[model samples]
Target: MKTTVRRDVLTLPVAPTGPENPLPPLRPPGDPHTPDERAKNGLPRDMARQVGYEPLRSLLPVRLLDGYGRKRTDTPLGTLVIENGRLRATVLPGYGGRVHSLLHKPTGRELLYRNPVLQPAGFALNGAWFSGGIEWNIGATGHTTLSCAPVHAARVTAPDGGEMLRLWEWERLRDLPFQVDLWLPEDSDFLHVGVRIRNPHEKPAPVYWWSNMAVPEERRVLAPADEAWRFAHPGGLRRVPVPVSDGADRTYPPRSEYSADYFFDVPDGARRWIAALDEDGHGLVQTSTDLPRGRKLFVWGTGSGGRRWQEWLTEPGTGGYAEIQSGLARTQLEHVRLDAGTEFSWLESYGPLSARADLVHGDWADACAETRARLADALPGEAVDAAYVAWLARADTEPGEVLAVGSGWGALEVLRAEYKLPGTPFDESTLGTEQAPWLELLRSGAFPEPCEVAPPGPTLVSRNWRDMLETAPARPLTEYHLGVAQWHEGDRAQAVRSWERGLERALSRWPLLRCLAVADAVEGHLERAADRYAEAFDDLCQERRDDGAAWTAATAALGREAISGLLAADRPEAARAVWDRLHETTRAEGRFRLVEAQIRYAEGDIAAVRAVFDEGFEAADLREGAEPLGDLWAAATGGEEIPARYDFRLRP
Candidate 1:
């Protein structure tokens, strides 16, 4: 009985069920989003019920793909990990593919509250809903049609060459396909979450998404609002403002000891972010652009009812978790109507927030200042253009120096080295500082307000480059196919030119960096290729895009050839950097340790390279199980002929 030393990539592919994949003629009808009421949602009347984990029927485990692509007799455990040194996520594929736990490694504590047990509670919008972790609620007005349904899960690469855990489930209520891609970019302190909700119906379909984050109990919520409104369930709505004594201000550790459930559509806040902090200055920040249209805070307080509900929701002693949830339209009560064949996608970011000062006021202003200051330190010299500030403040960090430190593209050495980046100073970083008057014209970003336009209804999906580029000049989705078509045609040079044209017209840096990366790799410019990969990745970290599924996957996998070229050029350090970001950015499957050993070998570690011959044969990821490395090293040392390696070839 021997335990496997896992040094290879692991793949557990869960196949598609079915749908009329309408666009492609020679494609599988395996997409679940059909034109009929095939997948419907509702728990009818389940208010009086007890729900917990059953034997998990209907889904049987299959053999898993090991590092060497060999079939193992073991059944898949239904969990996948996508880590980017800064953030780590444990995906629960078995349980609706929600993030079971999210961790910020810099701080040993778990950013998400982890459950010791896997019991479902009856206190959900549908039949049952599990508490804790980050849940992507999509579909019906309730806790989402897929809130409790098992979702298909896979590892994916993001367009900017970052690694991601992709999870999708068909909305049972409205025959729609929804996916959430969780990205962990290297060195960047935030976790980027990209979501795409597709309406496959012939008529306009009602769809919505809410990213729910559950932190520990006893936390304050900072949802800055001059006026807050919640649906009165039957009749009218109420208007509540901040610092109200009536306990309507659901900020930080709730003011009321009783259960306080607050939900509002598009709160009046300058920034699209909500925060929750524990006693210890440590907290988690949830930020987005226009993806979320509402903010919600749920609290059961420390009362008897709260304790009882907690015990009912979780297993005994497991405790409970509060939610700082976001909505796509109005509140969860309002649905964004999407036309047939239309898809809406947006980027959301989550980062570990540890502030030196305590912002107990729970105002939006305080939340904005703290998060802006902290992230500005984590990512220095980034063109910080945010709203709420009358003007933009100048950055003390030199653009050239920050860009030279790789601008946090891919795996940043500065982050690994543990350095304090410059913060938005009071002198010139804030709106009311000395530079406040001229900040608006001086800032480089589009100062966006809390996009009040109704989704689909009042404001439908704007697929045009002109409108899309107004907010996102980093990755233009409107003309992405021009480059993708050329890339698929196997003419990468033309693809690069097309992307260049796209950049000139759209000002998207992602296509340009990726185009440069492929060209550099083809021209044997491994260093530039590596840099381009990181730069493209950095561009994405700053701003990511997922217009279509194929385009997004292609964007992430484009750097594969560059990584191979770097390794062939004997630039293992650069190769390793790409691999680090790749693992965090995409579901790139290949041998990573060989490149690691090559890195060690290049760094003057002969003993480590020599050890490959002894223990490396058992390694599953090797193309020939250590034979290729052995022969290559032998050729270099004993003057023997080098073997032909297909992976190292540079071709069209």
Candidate 2:
């Protein structure tokens, strides 16, 4: 009956998460809303704190992962399973350490929504997020950048002296190292996860952590709150009554008409939990320690747009799922500050709950009480607190066995800062080619320059790295990286100067030119920006032709940007020329197909636009709030009813 952790392969039809886009994410993170709005909207006290704290100016260090397409193939993902006799948890070590499946052994029922396919969607902040299971969202409000990325995994001793699976990685957005440990007690039906986020830096760090569990939407979602803060697309937060909001019982996902987030206003000292129960009053329940108090329900409702979004995330025939989430703050919009040299830790438990069906379906208060009482009987809040305390003792225990390897950014950061992080060791060996250039820059005073043609190594924008780059010898690569860091730090004028200086002596001028183009666009110079984009695209094309397919990813990325800019500048012929020069494989991608459709639409060729849609292609990078497909359909076929598959307009 002892808990054991072992590695296994989870084979699913996975769309490959293709090469990262070379372009930097220039768009600023959405505003956290004014204080007056928070006050007027009835936001709780803690929820108001740090609402706009250290918002991201740019997603530096983390590159955009828009390269994935809709085409899927049978791919074997590495997984680690933690089982005790009563319950089993399957962890995708290669995918942000997501819990791919949680099974209640005796009942032979899956507790979480186990996705049949690994389809990378653009729900993540940095793109490439798959549906289903439990995802640990960190760094920012949206899905973590690591949604489709790997995390380092190892086997460690749990509180019960049994094997536990530990997944740890350095979150680049906030420059923090975090770890998630999954285990189950002997003969226990509930799976236990202990999470820890450490701020190794001297200054305070704004941290966000939300554990999102996907479950079948055909259930009554319950949380211990009468009033909740509802956030709909293209709107600010507003207080709404739970269960029944907007003249419908929203607890039932089908009752709503659009996608929305309902963050439960759990009262002070209330047991923090959320559950989704079927008509028979039997389903999964998640309860966590006091520190992780926030509970939320995100439903893509029964409307055509919502349903279409569901189908787009997975296969067409699969059942839809809703998210039940727990977080450190009252809402995902606010980030709690983790003080210097401090770490936040919490324990979470997942198990099946069965209550009286009538009470669960009746009055909202009665249903929440029924669910809470059942959860107390199964796994009490006090017991969860005790588990957290016990976990704290072993949080520093050195890991024993390596299960999977993630990015070496943690090791590089640790090596640079001489951090004495225990349990989760970012060993020197974990460092890879991505960390090589930084390691060289750290060791020698000079930043390594590219001898041959290749995209620039990823940029580091953290203050420490930025300071180091500032002191490095002045070379083209050094200037380029420094400019990126400066741009991320909000020094636009200096960033422009650095890029212009770098371009003067640059062998590969396209990267600097692209950065300058983005800067110009941000400064409201559209035509000038388009010209820079065109120049950059031409330079990148020359490099691709000379360097062969190694530059294909960069060429494709630059080509998309250039064409979009040209189209925006009313230069359809120029955009068409850029499209014509794209590699055939790049042109065949779903994203480019949409681009082609846009180009044709801009050129006043309605037939060509309709032809592209008739062929049907999935835009893998379809943004959360954008409705490009629906817009194109409307433009091509004026007033024609949009097909169900092409409709994903979330807002009214």
Candidate 3:
């Protein structure tokens, strides 16, 4: 049977991803894996010094996605399916173009975990990440900011002249355009994925890519190496023997007591691959071309906190799964430097492999050998390399049919730089209202201002856009955006000046006011920042229009920040006032419920704080390392044992 690609709908109970936070993420969203001095000293020479060598300063150009709640409803998510009668792969175009399912037709078994629900959790760098399937993480160490964002999708002819699903987007973080082409060869068991990342800029860019696959945790994961770089929560990295670590066989997810990352130290020149097989030695195997040399296993162990995290990421009753990932670097912490005008390309294959149950489940080395032998017999490494070569020839082929539309930022960049991206066209038609003002600035000399009442539009922080905004006529809107751009570029002094200038004639002062508040807090002016936050919230309330829904979301987002700032400044009454002003629905969200507990704690109402937790709540966007639940519990009960349900602490 010839490989076929078709559009389909994956209907599931999906939580609504509400409005994008209007605030620019002036701070790096908490990085759980940030290594400390001890961690830096603990690494092997290769990755030791390079830990956080080129980390993201902040999530700019991209706004935080903290809008999702625990509430879910039946939704039909758009999907694209490709099958060759032997293997079937389902891709969700709307959600990071994730490979949602991989089914082995002959055995009638699902290879990937195949998440039963589409629930957004606070895992992605910019928030809103769902568990399961294969997620293509690019641009940074943490989950890609694009996890919950859409990417441009289209149909293209594969190397074998079959229909291929191509998902491409201009990754905003690195200002690079990348593509992932998925196709299954006729009657072939393996599904081939060709990935390419192009740096069209004049300077070198740090590139990070990890194709993460979620497989059943019950399976024993096997990699080529015996030693792996282990990075765990509370921030430390150590090279430890694989399969066995901390007095236990670490390959089994349930054995570890805490969540961790095991980046396998695959020997140089080894055929790069990782597999997770059941007790019967039947499951998924992912093999990739040499360029993607890194392999990893991420486990949320059997501990209550780890299990709670699993439950938080998906439906409570769902079976747990672990991640088997492949990346371009030796480890996720280290980024490979891609030269200007050059590109990073590789091919990866995913399929099932069956081996002798005794050998697969026996000695560690034997199990690895058994899986490798089965993989070579099933689909040789030479075949994967040859497939990549054939794909490179067709990499530039223009897309035949457009499947889905992503953000217009790529098209905007293409227009700005006249990028000749062939297979993946960021056409001008993709441009929307978000790009309208910027388009005007690109064409006309002036930056058009928004309506006096409407909140400022999204930010554009690329150097090119920043330079443009710097030169444009300095109106309130122009200065407001200029401040954001300047802040993104790490020019704090200039950013403050720009925001302060914008506030001079700004009809809408909340955005600018909130920005200044952030600046003040960063500079250690806590009380001053709180005053600005209160004023900003008040301004937003005054500017709230008849459109209740939009305003409610905006108010909630700004209100949360305002309340937090107020509480930090020891202004409990002021924080309470902002809380009172929030919409009823907004105040009732799990995130705000936690905030309410904080407010009660600040007001010294220990009973009220305890009462808030008695009525259980889950902060959907609970940040990594910010344990409000634990802190609140301790404050309320005076060192009582933290309940298992609220305990998401990664460390003991």
Candidate 4:
């Protein structure tokens, strides 16, 4: 057992900050508590470092979860590497306490698809979620809002005379508490995993938890369930049979054209275990202790979208992998309702399993037998020895010294001493030197020249800036910026044209579609705006329709945007239709009520607008944030000024 604090990392500024620690950890005025209560890139005031929160739904799709909000001058980060007779485990203290890697020493196998880089792609909702290793999902799934912030980590001796890495955090999303204890029994092969979560609120909250494990692709996924359900990307559930879906056994990998992401439910009156076996006999099994658990598999398909996501998540070689996820109860869609302050806990054990070929297609009985055999083989001889060296993004810069490095899996690579590298010490530059300048500008919070778009106002922005740039940038981002700039310059007619072109390149970007719809409305293309807003709203609803309480807030904001977009274009009937559809799920939501009031005010129905404010919203309502709503209510009654821009801002 060893702990390391890289002094060099201390010199790395522009990260976490704390109060009374040189850096002010300045939060916006009057906006103190953010999602995760917003831990800036700083160490916890106490030894038990707490993870930060993020917005339930972030407006900006930037990766702020990486402690970028924290000032580097505030706190120190460290890593812990623990090893025993046969297995080695590594945990990153600063980065969400995620288990970086688990190595089976005898076979020299990196048990997990250990990512060699800390490169974060703008994929996850709150951003800063990476591939490989294991990740913890609390609150509203999709890689927790605190996926990158530090969690409380402690090195404690297990009751069974083994080393335990105890990590815990107060997940702010639902005001719930979570704790994960990783125990490696002395001379044992498995890592005993224990998890406990408690809802602190007086009332019940919809709690979601998923332990996402990234393993090699094409691994045989074995579960006790006979029937599996494919979870659709937007947010729906369709039942699919085990080992096959549309003429393909998703469990066997080599994914479909797009992406194969779905949950495998444990059949009633079945055993509780999910295992994955690679072609090389070495396997990993996650077994629970009669707890309500479910399994999931995600294989990024072979299509352009799939390939692009693969490249985005990792530096090649560490490319293809599937996430063997374990959920608390059921799918992310139908999440379990955790009673207020009711402490829920479970224990799961994971270890190496090299079973016979015959057991590959067998049921739970045979799988358990093989797993037991593997565990028996894992127990060491009389002499039990422990202690090994592993690095936590620590690299010693020296030529050919046989560094026991890697992202804590194997000696992947090493940074020459004092060599400061971007990404992580484990990462090699994959986007190449050509993309370096573009990436640098993006990181510096600046648009890469062509992406310079001013806000919509009397001010004339750089319209069609891509055409003016000397380099002739070919990226979809170029068009996205061009469209924004054109729209800001009051050229909505041209902005719609540019955004449509941009959407062709960045097809998955929903925000672009939303912006395009707004531009269409501004250009008096009411029919186009109505149609586009409907599509955008559908897309948004698909992804977030079932994220529990989070959905309520998200849909409130989304409904307001959709309905307002339609109303702005003078398509009152179309706006009503959108409102009815949203009412199916987000019925009588406060934000929509605000939008309804605004619509009536726009229609010269002052009484209706006043009546809405008279029916006051609760403090917990999502519409409470826009304090200006009250003033808008007053204006409708008191004959005060009502600016049309307020509709676009949705500030009401």
Candidate 5:
């Protein structure tokens, strides 16, 4: 079966229009009459009455099995309950009081419930004197009070007899909406209220909301990438990036434990928008609202997880509440400046798609195209100019006759010299400077062999060396050898550059490139060193071989040393695998028993490693051949520290 990737996009609906009617009134307060009077009036006479004469019967019963028992009534404000298996609130009705939205099972719905109304202590409503209301002691102003009202579907009254609009709908699979619109008095300064949502459903629903609310984390106000705005918070302030293209969006995943708060300002005429996109890019819900001239944008997302007010707002590991606000600071809703009589509005939409494939064909492609165009526009123009200069420089210094001369050496030398170039007297010291030119000549495909080895006279040797170094100043091979010499003489930086230059010129010439890498490793560029060794090893491994015992032994030894070096560099796991390969290769060809013992010891099989050494020692008769094995055993058994005694080297 084949696999496929999908995408999804969410779009918002148009805003509502026209002046809407005030919502319906809340239920009347419970009767305070005696059981007989209440019965005659057709009220629930058996309702349990609490202090302040508030009837608690409408609330869902808090059974002992439900974990609260009778004492459940002694909860903090806004506690929801289940009575007759229906969810309800336990707070007195109205602004100063709490209201609970209960979640019902089966249909997975929530029912709204209100507490008793509390008017000022001495205030009279209708014909009765009401003694229930919130008391505020402002300085010396004795007492100011507020009352609560019952909760209803369309309309509800605030403590001060102000009206509010409530829109609520519940469905099993669909999420519930519990929003209240507060009707502020023409001159009111500020508004505040506490809300609670109760969920009794078996499955948790994803709940989210946006409001003119502020929390610790500064609200994140987002707009189209083209919009310009500034972000402000305790973190300081900065102008927001106006994306010239799409696919640029801001995200604030739920912060598990961080305090955050900030505000954003949308310029007077700018439109501000915010959105929440789920992980798969599907199920996007967005809100766009008009901003008052000079109003700041506020956005926030909840950073914690848990049951809050009986509602699970976020998933256990990942969930948060986000809010996008318009304008800065809290100011008079009407007095706030605006361009003309511009109406401030918010747009929101939420829906699920059939699959992510829907988004890829729609939103994702558009976003990608926009991003590509923007990048193309931003690219610097000088890149092409730089390339043109580089190509011109290469053409100007093209090689001449020396390349042909070097190429003729192999044929000339084979005719006279019995021994070939490999027989040349080249050791570590001469390898860099004295012999570098010849090596370079050999490395350049132009030369197949060294200058014919003249007789061992001083004049002949000097002439050969001078000719090799002088012939190819432009060839990459000469510079590479000189670099190697500089490196051996302790001029490391020069060595590296020379090797790099050599690599650049001869990369397509694998043999020379591989040799330069080897030189680099010998100069303590360990990473480069390992790379060179690997290249060499790969080349050797690919060639079929038999009967070349010395060559095979030398190659295996090199592999062993490289593996050890990797181990000492804190790559034990990688080194172990390399060592395994080395062991198999060496064992297949019947060589390096001591190296095999070392491999076992390095792999942490100390006992078996020691036995190998012991056997080798005994077989070699203890005196003449046992010394190395004895030392190996000592290192494996912790009698001697390996690195300190050996400096990670082995005698050839």
Candidate 6:
């Protein structure tokens, strides 16, 4: 099957321009902030200053006349010449073949230019000239083929009856065909440009495209992705890496400051798929199908210093390229070039998702998934699975899948035990070290002799008890503890028998003697492991109180029981009451808003959940150091196909 390529057309009509005069230099935005402000507020200041850059000058002295009048310029970047109040910019040698600003003849509004290199030093205007009009062509095929060309200048007219100046000269390649046309709208807010490319090759070609523009930092680039790889340049020399750990996989490095000349690349076949985001995740530029994957994926940002000839190539600290390569560094070049006659195309549609704030979480998630899917497709199948497994293993603490019958439960208990320990306290000397400290504290009764007003609590009271146990430690006691640990490891029946024997021996010594609250909690956890929700809830609750950490502990146990009841009985309403109480208590205690959101979602209140997200977004610190709630929310709301815990599958 052959892949057919097409372009979607969009038109923008320019509004009527007021009477024009000799235009003054372009002005910057109203509230132009410094680099520090941009960094502190997460804004992109480079783009906002594009218009105010130096005007383009022409290399050769030239004069052109349209019905409006005559225009002339000398120098390189380009020159602003007007005919009958109509304005057109032509190349002037000193101006460097680049056109900085082109204003409407009547309105004075700026003309928009879109290119893959979002920011290029300059443009090459007038590469090839035919009689009566100018033809602009770009080499697309592997060979030099000018298959597509813009309509001759004679056939095109400025929107306000102004002269159209040829901005850059383009060369057509044989195998690839690319062309862009400027359409001045008679009545519109935007200057419309249409781009087209055609590839008739038989093999897949890797390409990168981007519409390089200087936009404001307040505007956010919105593309699909969980995370973005970001690199920031502080001095214009070395690029730093900042890894966004919040489920976002993009690799952008973090730096303390930013200079100009930052390059970012996207991969091929992913056209207009990535987005440029302002500090608040707002969209700045949208791409069309004409954007080259190689160019679009590879993004470059130059600072005001670079814009001026003063610091060109001066290496202003660490400003370098920030590009997303199609493949790794080694294979990128091969990926960009397509075989002859093979068809390749990139279609990107851009628009604003937000007016003030940056892209939202849903938007970010969608973007992340799209980018990840592309990356996955790029990798080999075996490699993909292996990578995924590695990722899961890194995230998991247990030896086996959390749902595995014997192994999984056992692993969980071992993990919990390890978590409870103070930190790697299981070595040969661990027991001795732990005992020595307590023994010293106990023999001296240092814990009982308090410098503070309140006496030691039951924990300190139980210090003596622990000391006695340590002093007269026996094999049976050790065996009992091991048996209890085994019970926690999911050897339930064995644990019961061992505990019974230990209980008998302990009772023989003292009728009131019992095991630790931790033992009870473990037993309770195991009972619930067999679908005994009520029993488990009761056990955990009792253990919580017995452990003298009742308030929060009981609340946690109640929350789990409520969720379990909801899952078991399928009665959302009853579960909602429990969720509400938990919400109230947690809010009162100022903790776990995400948990509250999960509970609200379980109660079928999506708005409440979203509201919680909004609140969390405002209180950015809350999201820091918090566990993920997406999985729990999915399970509790019946959206997940798998259980949250491994309890059900192991039951006989």
- Evaluation by TM-score, superior candidate among 3 and 5: 3
The full ranking of all candidates by lDDT, starting with the best, is: 3, 2, 4, 1, 5, 6
The number of clashing residue pairs in model 6 is 135
lDDT of 4 by residue, 1-652 (tens): 2322111122122222111111111111121112221122232232112111222322111112311221124343355665776777777656666777888888888888877656544333344556677777876646675566666555554545444566665464454556666666666777766777765455777667788888887677777665676644333346677766788766776646546466676765554566778765567776655554677877666654456456545555655877888887555443466676576766666678777756665554575467545544653211111211111111121112111222211011121122232212223322333234334433443334323221111111222222342133534555565665455444556766766876787633455677776666655787787778778777666655354543444444446666777776677766666676664435454435666776777677888876776675321112101335546755786845433222111111
Candidate whose lDDT is highest: 3
Which lDDT tens digits does candidate 5 get at residues 1-652?
A: 1111111121211111111111100112122211332222322222122111322221110000000001112222322121222222222222222222222332343221111222111111111112211111110101111112222222333333333222221111111112222222222211212121223223443221223321112212223333333222222223344322123333232431222222233334433333233333322212222322222222222322111200121113322333333321211111111122121222221111112322322453354343223222322123223322332222212121110011122232232232221111111321323234344454552322224321110011122333453455635545544543443344557656765676676522333344455455555667765655555455445441443543444345446555655544445555555556553545443124555565676677888886664453211101110135447656777776432212212111
Q: Please state the error at residue 299 of candidate 2 in Å.
A: 0.6
Q: Write the per-residue lDDT of candidate 6 for residues 1-652, one digit (tens) a residue.
A: 1111111122211111111111111111111111222333332233223212221221111111100111112212212232223333221211222223334445453332211111111111211111101112233111111111111111123333332222221221122233222323223222233333334344543332223332322222334322232323331122222123334323331221222222233434443343344344333233333234322122222322222211111123323323221111111111234455443332222222223232232354454454334333433234423423332222212121110011021122222233221111112221232143234343543322222221111111122233343343333443344343343334556545554565555412110012222233344543232233333333333333232233443444345444544444555554455555553444433234544665676677787876665454211112111224444445454564432221111111
| lDDT tens readout by residue for model 1, 577-649 | 6656554424323234455455556666766765553444222223111144544466335644323321211
Judged by lDDT against the true structure, how good is candidate 6?
0.29
TM-score-best of 1 and 4:
4
Encode model 3's per-residue lDDT on 398-468: one tens digit a residue.
99989999999999999999988888899999999999988999999689976546666788898888988
Top TM-score: which candidate number?
Answer: 3
Candidate 4 weakest ten by summed lDDT: 17-26
RMSD of each: 24.4, 1.8, 1.1, 21.2, 38.1, 30.4
In model 6, how large is the Cα lDDT of residue 69?
11
Which ranges of candidate 5 are over 4 A from the true structure? 1-446, 449-467, 473-492, 505-528, 543-554, 579-585, 588-591, 617-631, 640-652
lDDT of all predictions, in order shown? 0.47, 0.87, 0.89, 0.53, 0.29, 0.29
Pairs of residues clashing in candidate 2: none
Q: Candidate 5 has what TM-score?
A: 0.25
**Span of 10 residues, lowest total lDDT, candidate 1:** 401-410
Instruction: List where candidate 3 sits over 4 angstroms from the true fold.
Output: none
CA lDDT of 88 in candidate 2? 87
Better of 3 and 5 by lDDT: 3
Instruction: Name the better of 1 and 5 by lDDT.
Output: 1
